[model samples]
Target chain A: MSFFSKIFHPSSYAPSAPSLPYSYDQQGQTYSTTSYPGNYSHQQQQQSYYGQGTSGGGGGYSYGHSGFPPGTSPDVIRSFEMVDRDRSGFIDENELQQALSSGYQRFHIKTVRLLMFLFKNPHDSRRLGPKEFAALWSCLGQWRGIYERYDRDRSGKIDLLELRDALYGIGLATPSSVLQVLISKYDDGSGRKIELNFDSFVECGVILKGLTEKFKEKDKGYTGTASFDYDEFMSMVIPFLVSYD
Target chain B: MSFFSKIFHPSSYAPSAPSLPYSYDQQGQTYSTTSYPGNYSHQQQQQSYYGQGTSGGGGGYSYGHSGFPPGTSPDVIRSFEMVDRDRSGFIDENELQQALSSGYQRFHIKTVRLLMFLFKNPHDSRRLGPKEFAALWSCLGQWRGIYERYDRDRSGKIDLLELRDALYGIGLATPSSVLQVLISKYDDGSGRKIELNFDSFVECGVILKGLTEKFKEKDKGYTGTASFDYDEFMSMVIPFLVSYD
Candidate 1:
């Protein structure tokens, strides 16, 4: 029989095909798909309320905002150029290195490692170009809490204070005593309250190695490649947080 | 004024603070906030006609029928030892490679690149264990199309006629005149049809450089480390496809 006929008429093809490709060798125990943490209902609710483009009457949903400019090849190139300000023909390791090192104090070793794992698989010599870089940036932008907190002065620099707010916003608490010590030690000493700049702020936070370690350990082995796979991440984190604290 | 007070009453803070961040680079680019792809009208029609989720109200629409089981632990390590009949502890790369090399014809290079891009990105690497692997397997089940075309008897094997039919499916016109030439060249003197089992069929497809190039070009260079930044990729591809085609 013809292929079209087989597809349309299952009887023509004989017994029903398997719904999914996976099968066990002999354990007879079906692989469980429901293992992610957090209530499925809650996760679905959160995604529906906040996910920017889950589904829509169109391929995209604007939610009553201005639509995306008609994307064109030139526009894509232009956007890439804006991100790769140096126009180095390719976004080499140096550029990514710079971005990573820019404010090292805020970055944990584990976080950086996690980021690297996504880049090129442990020094395979493939540096992320404009496309890979853009994807990561777009993901960071969608991290609502992080983005919201980082936009200090609503200007969005997240230079220092904003970063502080972000860490706290995500449930990482900084001890007040530690903050006091940092301010007093690093302040310009003009006898006025000190505004913590990047360096000083990172010092305060990074010094809490125990805290960083705890958070990192908590995030072990979650190397999913899709940002939208929040269910995966959230599931790991929530149960661990409840258990950890 | 206190920082909180200044924030609450923006007039109380230094006027320069709020304006400064926005104006640092460009003032008017107040984020697109909403943008997406494809024709809205078609999507709306599909939504109503097919009962497909198409709007902010439906969270699962982006994935179509590809839905993960509800309530999976993002960090839970569902032991695979029970699943692997040999107790390999892990499903090694060799298994995947062998599977591809054996039954499958040369996979589209673009599909490989896309898969690599998905697997390589760090943000998305959140422990792609068995369940996650199943999801990916389901999505790529489209490969069954190739198998179906070649396996003529529905007995999961291919004879000469089936192979020829498979080749012809790709627009490799097999004229009646060429059929005689091929039969004479390939068939046994006994008049039996020459057959290519899965392995030989795979080898033939892989050797086709033209098909490889087509797919590789299709799957290269996307940013979003966690997901294919459909928006960014489409922005460049759409314009090029429209103008060039």
Candidate 2:
């Protein structure tokens, strides 16, 4: 299974990484984990996040966690070193962007923008570092928050009843009319449950990715930069699509 | 009350709107009142989301789920009309640059490059518009979210306890230890909670205005056009700063 597959199927790969087996010394600074998050079975996701490129210094996301063995693998260490710029053991927006930008001449500038927005703080100048980066990737890699609403019963699939209740929990009670429309669109032949499998995931990703690319081009046009910037990348893109259909 | 203040106290002002009653149905779109959740007390908070500014023809976020009289002083609208060359209800980054250049000439080139990073998207050709501009403002205006981890109860205030929690939330538990080092040396004992009040709002607006100026300058620096081309903006600026603590 690729890492993308693993992220959506935590149950299938939970055994690969139990609790991220790393520890901290009072500070929130964490060490390296003994295992992978199983969901990241594929390496492309790492490439996307770390900013590594096959040819030279384009950029990509780093994969190494803090305090982990240095010789995990060239690809892994390369990922770590890129994000661990300044070797401070933390990968902030700066480091992450540096890591994620490798091997590509053009990226969706909006992605970088979103990243900068997510990590920015008016009161502090500190950027996200290694530990924070790791935690974020761990969460995103598995699409944890994207669930929107979850079926806690672990029934292996989420149905309308389960999804509706989850939305209600978040203070959003969809009118029955809207629900019917969504069901007719998403549900296939049978009306039992609506499961968002890999196809749906890929479809959603493609659509969002398209929107993201649009923002990147505009960002490039305004800034006059040929390459995509990490900070303003997504901020300029997400707003148009933040609403549900 | 100033525009920023009205966001917090909507009822204090008289409703003089003359257009169709305050329904979300403008521009052939049906918007839900629920979409404008929270009261005017929080509108100012939305304005500051992701560091929105008022330098050019960008959108402004107004709270209060009611109506504003028709001829209720087109000051805000003036800000938009100041640019919007075609008055098509949308202002691209280039239009924004033109609006700001007329005011602040020394906004510089690097600043525009940085600003572009803040708005780029990789998926589509869309740039910032009024509705998006308002939404972005709202998302970042709630300054509490920026520092809320430090303020536990969400009472919209930050105390010492809250500050300590913030330190812990970021992985540093020893508040006394780190605070003694960073804060004691740099704290200055101002007793300020870094509130997002009116004064700060103005300062933020000025900063965004500065961004507009910078964007115009960058465009001029490139082909002397009103807007910067994608390549010119990026190549001219190196190692752009994402944040300065």
Candidate topping lDDT: 2
- Model 2 accuracy (lDDT, Cα): 0.32
Model 2 misplaced stretches (Cα beyond 4 Å): A1-78, A102-125, A139-245, B1-97, B100-102, B105-245
**Residue-wise C-alpha lDDT for candidate 2, range A21-79, written one tens digit per residue:** 12211222332211111221121121122221221132234335454332222333445
| CA RMSD, predictions in order | 29.9, 20.1
Model 1 lDDT tens row, A10-45: 212111101100111112232221111121111111
Off by over 4 Å in 1: A1-78, A85-89, A93-121, A124-126, A139-164, A177-193, A196-245, B1-245
What does candidate 2's lDDT look like per residue over B16-103, in tens digits?
A: 1111111211123221111011111112111212233222232334432123222222333444445568876665555644543424
The complex in candidate 1 yields a DockQ of 0.04
TM-score of each: 0.22, 0.29
